[model samples]
Target chain A: MALTIAIHSYKGGSGKTSFAINLASAYASVGKSVCLLDVDLKAPSSFNYLLPEAKHWVNDIFEGRYGVMDVVKDVSKEMGTKGAFYVGYSNPDIVAVRGISSKDRKWQSKALKLLMTAKRDLSNAGIDIVILDTGAGVDFTSVNAIAVADYVISVGRPGASRQRLMEQVIGGVYMPLDKDCYIIENMCHNDNPTDLSGKKFDLPVLASIPCMCDVAVRCDNEVLVLTEPDHAFSKKIYDIMESLDKITS
Target chain B: MTDNSSTEEMIRLLREISGKLDRILIQGSADNESDDGILDVLDVMTLLTLPDHLRTTATALFELGSATADELAERTNKERAVESNYLNQLVRMGHVAKNRKGRKVYFSIGEGLGK
Candidate 1:
């Protein structure tokens, strides 16, 4: 069975997508069939990072325009890596982006069911893990995605509003939903203290990643962990993946 | 540390960050800035839009497991005829599942909306 992990944050610009891609690549590196899905339909950046040489999109699969299997692009060959590393990207087209956020009640239920079916299909495809990079904050896209996840890694940055919202969301949303939530303090300034797992938040702090310009540059170009495995940022990504491998196994 | 102190520190950090802005852009937490309103097909189905009696009936069935229209009438305080009409609407909406047993209509929240 595929263990679905959702990388979420209460606000944007928290390195949420970057971590999702890094973790998925890490799992693939360890000889696991991994699929990184960009469910952040409104403003998807995963397609920009991962090589999107495929035709079908995640939005098409989500909106019932295409089958889940049809949209999954086998990216392991392109990335020059081993194991299955597939990417199901969201539609970056202007018109299609506007249509994915459906509000109809009956349609919402069916869409939820579709996501469930997609998970089953992914598992049937022998995918070891399905990592979802959802839209930031508590939209239905994020909320529903988080609800379905087997595990959640909430990415956070050093800010006031972001921190406060993270606290409230954890207490009000995640706790009530009975979710296993782990916090990752991402893009930390070098000057700040690390090891905030329990000192700062109520949940287990999975990893503390320092702000690195090299990773940011790669994020703008290619998947950082895959392109430059020797980089410090990439090392942290591997460390996180190693920790996750233990927990999920 | 107590959750209250941690929460206070979080509020202080929030204020400190907002203080760096050239001018006030946003006030309070972003939780209130939910754009997930009923503007599109993907936004969550609003529970607020559901009829009060239908919601009550669903809640009653959710707690009771399954109840006949007459049993629901006593719990929801609606007459048999009135309760059955609402029950039929809920069944039509798929909010409640109906089973027939010797002219009695038992309703319970089922499938997608039940949980």
Candidate 2:
């Protein structure tokens, strides 16, 4: 089976999706089959990043209208990778988002099953890694992803409030679930590196990515690791990739 | 032979045959249970009865069909002892069944469950 990873955060705007796409791309760049799923049904962003037109969305899959393979968009050739790269995008339409948000627990449970089946199918199709860009907080959507994932990368910016929220989530949710959890401190502005030792939880820090003004201002969805290989942000993402490799290996 | 000696021998043989029958009946019942418990194409949402942690463990077991605590620990990124604890919890909840094979114990979803 492929290693399933859910990139989650305590709150929004933690650069979770960016890290997920870049990390998926990093894996794909090295000839590893990768599938990046935009599971943040509430706020789908991979569309802005990839801008690929879709015949189907994850919503349709959850509703049992389509299978994962039907919705998977292969971009391996476009990515110029030796291995395949596939994406399962969430519906980005307003009605679609509202519809998913309105889903009850029963629907969520069914959706989780569908996702599990989809993951197994992906593994059978030779995908090496499956990365889910999950919604923030303790919502059912994000919990579904966390439940299915083997490794969780909880991304949070460097701040007291974010840290407190992160600690609460880690202690309350991740710890109880006994998941292999890691923290990624994104958007660190301090000159000196931020220390994670003071945190309440014991999750290892995967990377402390410094904020880049240029990358922030670019205002486009192109993966920095793929577009600008020399960017500092790209290097940080690659470092995260290496750390993941070392750990998962 | 004395009459009492012959009767005692007959009783001993009957007791021995009864014990063997009991063992065979017990083994047959277990086999029936195993056959009945073979979950196939089951809806994964049937696991909602369990807590999230146990549900995750059960789901992992469903994926694996059957696995030891060590193998489940690898899949779940948890300590072997932790996985063992959760597996035992599932066993208690009747969501999973454990069997010993050699020195290793393997667990799988109990009945009417699949990934």
Candidate 3:
């Protein structure tokens, strides 16, 4: 069975998208067929990194103009992966973003159904995992991604306020949906300690990655997990994957 | 297409689904063996016909296969009474079947929702 994971956050600037991309890269490097979807339609930055070229974007799939297969692009050769790495990028144009964001509840409801169908299609294509890079907050897009996911990894910074926001979302959304949720304390400073124990939150803290100034400042779409496997940040990413395997298994 | 056109399209689809659901219910009512109202097989499109609140409940039930309201409550993080009402609503819609096994009431997809 293909496991669908949604990397989500209650707020932005928490390294959610980067973690999602690297997590997908890590799995592909290990010969697991993975499909990373840039479902954060309003702020699609995956295109800046993956630089995928396709005739159809993910926006086309939701609009009933095309299906998942029509937009899926394989970059296994480019990424030098033993397994296939496919991506379904969303259109990053301002007009496209506004259009998708302005969609009504009816359209969003239909979009959710389309997403479920897309999940099945990806699984049928032999994908081992499907990772959704979701937008922050309780928007329609985020909820749809959460609804279809088997697991959700919520990324947050180390702070009392951020922790409170994380707790509210977990209690209000993840708990209600009965999702398997894990927390990643991203960009933790030396002075600000992240509670690794599960008592801090209802879910387990998957990892507490410290602030690497050189890495945190780099604006490039460099996937350190694949390029620099020996790096401390990369090791933490792998550790997170190991923890996920144990829990899921 | 504009929002107006999209809204119109959604209405059209809902009408089509409603017609299909009506036919399924009537045929199921006639074919039911145990005299337990309409017993039918819901397909994937059934998800689209449900409202957001009911959709969430139905989705959880679909994942659980068959469960009591209390079991569904635990999974959905809703009160058992709320889940019971939702399950009853699904039963009325012929999308789910209700059974009494001992003292507990179990609700399951009518036949199967295409897995």
Task: Find the candidate with the highest DockQ and give its number.
Answer: 1
Candidate 1 - CAPRI tier?
Answer: incorrect
Error of 3 at B98 (Å): 15
Residue-by-residue lDDT tens digits, candidate 1, B31-87: 333332222222223422455676556545543567898898898788988889988
Task: Give the better candidate number (1 or 3) by TM-score.
Answer: 3
List pairs with backbone clashes in candidate 3. Answer: none
For all candidates, the clash counts are 8, 0, 0
Model 1 lDDT per residue over A157-214, tens place: 8665567788878866666545688889898886654343454456888888888876
lDDT string for model 2 (B1-97, tens) is 9999999999999999999999999999988655444332223334543577776777777667779999999988999999999999777655677
Say which prediction, candidate 1 or candidate 3, comes out ahead on DockQ: 1
Chain A TM per candidate, in order of listing:
0.92, 0.95, 0.95
Kindly report the docking quality category of candidate 2. Answer: incorrect
The segments of candidate 3 whose C-alpha lies over 4 angstroms from its true place after superposition are: A196-201, B1-56, B61-115
Off by over 4 Å in 2: A46-49, A191-194, B1-115
> RMSDs, each prediction?
16.3, 16.2, 12.8
Among these predicted structures, which one has the highest lDDT? 3
lDDT of candidate 1 at residue A60, scale 0 to 100: 75
